[model samples]
Target: MISKQYRLDELAKQVQGEPVGQSDLKLKRLASLENASSDDIAFVNADKFLDLARSSKAGALIVTEQLRAQLQDVHQNFIVVANPYLAFAILTHTFERKHEQRGIESSAYIHPSAMISDSAYIGHFVCIGENCVVGDDTVILSHTKVDDGVEIGKQCFIDSHVTLTGECTLADRVRIHANTVIGGEGFGFAPYQGKWNRIAQLGSVRIGNDVRIGSNCSVDRGALDDTVIEDGVIIDNLVQIAHNVKVGANTAMAAKCGVAGSTVIGKNCVFAGAVGVVGHINIADNVTVTGMSMVTKSISEAGSYSSGTPMLETAQWKRAAIRFKQLADVPLTQFAKKLDHIQAQIESLESTFKLRK
Candidate 1:
């Protein structure tokens, strides 16, 4: 990890922010408003944090024009940007600890048939099986297993304990966190005569460039074709992406999101925490599924979608649950039909009253 310090004006130029205080103030780190000290810089992205920003003892602050106006009375240094949150994000890379690539360890095992670039870093006890190719500047951390025929691209980071098997391929700049199982067997079985039979997973996983998958996620190998995770997709921890699933580019899935087999999710989609997408469905681009929603069918249009009921009081929820069960006996179609008939009767009564008058 590299330690860096930046001047207030220097950091402002990194994010195109306007520094309104002492430009020479040295900032060593970025911290939250509550935790920032005299040398650290903090950010105020929303109104909720304005109070804390006012009282923050930090050397400087990152703020939007609106927030800067609100904090004009406060005695604080300001680095005004168009979007404080975005500025904070850009500045994070400046202060974030980055791994330095070193040569492969002697304890690491690389088969004679494997081709590992000299620039690539293979950590202690890591294993690269036969016919594997690791590209330039790729870092495979300790205890990771790259099975036969697996190919990792340039500048990739495969964290500790990850399993890249079944001839998987990863593009450049991919980051797979610790304990993720890529190209593991898909959950495919046949219901034979009073018995279950396992089906061979003949396909692997193909990850695109700049994809980041979190720890403990299981991206199962396909039964026939490769499971595809497109470019710039970011998946959070504990998510399950089943066999033959194609996650589109720049799509984001939060923690515990599950997509069953053969589901094709569209690009620029957002699946909130715990969202469950069923099998064999296609979700359109720019779609957003809210938290805890269950997607059981295809979405042909781009829009925000949600399912299941929002939380209510226990008593209210119990009554609503009863009403939910009653829908089976009196479906919505029946209710619509009954309402149409009642509307016709009302019109007839109105006409008869006009004739009498």
Candidate 2:
């Protein structure tokens, strides 16, 4: 572990939380409330989880102002903050374990024509192909392959088992997690003589600075135009970006989200987990798509959009699904006939009153 320690007072100011008990106490690691021991620190953001804090074995707790008074007699040290969860995230770097430095392994292969900066580190079994450029202070971890004509910028970290295919370009400070395959051939097939003919992916992927791509994600290269990701875009694990997609700056997408071919995503958008956007659609700027939503059409409005059946009990969902299936069979004409019968009865009563008058 990194073993770096931070004073509780210093962290309290950063997170804007009130400090209860000893503010001078040093925290070495962060842990969940249920799993925290005497040496570890934990945070509680939700009031519903206050009961867990009362019985927690942790030495210190990070909490909001409202929750601090409730834990006054809990005997454990507490740090009251504005955003406990965000505070915990801010402090996560302090307790993060440092990686040990190792020299490049002997098994790694580097092409004679490849231009790797002297300051860059190449790990075990890494393969750098012909005419590739690895920039200064970049780290290519074990089993990574940088194909020919690829250009990786300064201070990027390419994790293990990543494949950067030919003609790909990553700008500065790009961090790619393990098993991510960039610049792969897009899913394109043409039918000829009742069989699928593969279309050659001749274009490339151009990613801007400070983009962080998660593990096991696949970003396909374009078919005729570049698949571009602008600066500060963050993508989660298992995402698939199809050919010729342009994702704008600072857009964040959660895990398992798929953007189809030729879709253009605007700046500062947020897509929840498992959201799927159809091909050739355009999403406006600052749009937020909720989890499991299927975007079959273009979103011209810059607002949050969501669609899907919510979670229900198995029996309840089954019953609802069955009712939904039978809805089309219900006759509107029958309902209109019943309404006409009621109207005739009301009119007859009115005529009987007029005759009495």
Candidate 3:
């Protein structure tokens, strides 16, 4: 068990919380309200969780000022803050998994022609190919492979089993999680004599600074131009980014999302999980795509977009789907006939009025 403690006063300043508990009390770890013990710390985002806060076994609770007033009677220690979740995240990081430092292992293979900076740390069984430039303070973990001519910048952490293919360039402070592959060949083919011929992918991937790519993600290299990921981009696990795509700065994509080739995504856009974007489409800046959406066209405006069948009971969804499919075949002639009959009745009434006149 990890038993690291933090001073309440120091944590309050870091998380912008007002401490009501002992300032010197050491907080070892954070936990949920239901699961926390007297030695653990927990947080409340709103008053809806006040009951849990009151009944919690935690030594202290972090809560917003609004919620703190409602919990004045609770005997548990407290810290008041503006955003409890953000504060909890800050505190959680204190006990979160620290990045392991695996110094250069004897079994690792560094090519004679590779220029690795003295400050970089290469882990066990890692391979660095010819003419590769690994910058200062970079850590390439175990079983990873850096192909020839690749350039990785300063303070980058390339996690275990990651493969950086040839000629890929990563900017400073990039963090690539385990088993992610960058700069692989794009899926390009041509038909020749009833057989598919592979097209040589000539372009590389250029990733900007402060990019965080999650585990098991695959980013393909371009066929003609570079696949560009701009600064401060956060990509979730298992995402697939195809060739020649240009993702703008500060954009985020959730897990299992896939963007086809040549698609240009604008800045500050958010894509939820399993959102599939077709090839050659342009998504505007500040766009937010809902989960499970299939984007097939260009979006010129900055707004939220969604498309998909909503969750429904199986029987109800089937009935609705059947009716929707038959809507296009509904007869317009029937409506036209009904309108004609109504018009004839109006004419008859007008004739009777004329006869009276």
- Judging by lDDT against the true structure, name the best candidate: 1
Superposition TM-score, candidate 1 onto the true structure = 0.93
Backbone steric clashes in candidate 2, count: 3
Report the lDDT of model 1 for residue 138.
92
lDDT of 1 by residue, 217-250 (tens): 9999899999999999999999999999999999
The CA lDDT of each predicted structure is: 0.94, 0.90, 0.91
lDDT-best of 1 and 2: 1
Give per-residue CA lDDT, model 2, range 76-104, as digits (tens): 58887778888889878666663445445
Instruction: Please give, for residues 246-327, the per-residue lDDT of candidate 3 as tens digits.
Output: 9999999999999999999999999999999999989999999999999999999999999988999999999999987786
lDDT of 3 at 46: 81
Better of 1 and 2 by TM-score: 1
Q: Estimate the TM-score of every prediction.
A: 0.93, 0.81, 0.88
Clashes of 3: 0
**Weakest 10 consecutive residues of candidate 3 by summed lDDT:** 95-104
Error of 3 at 271 (Å): 1.4
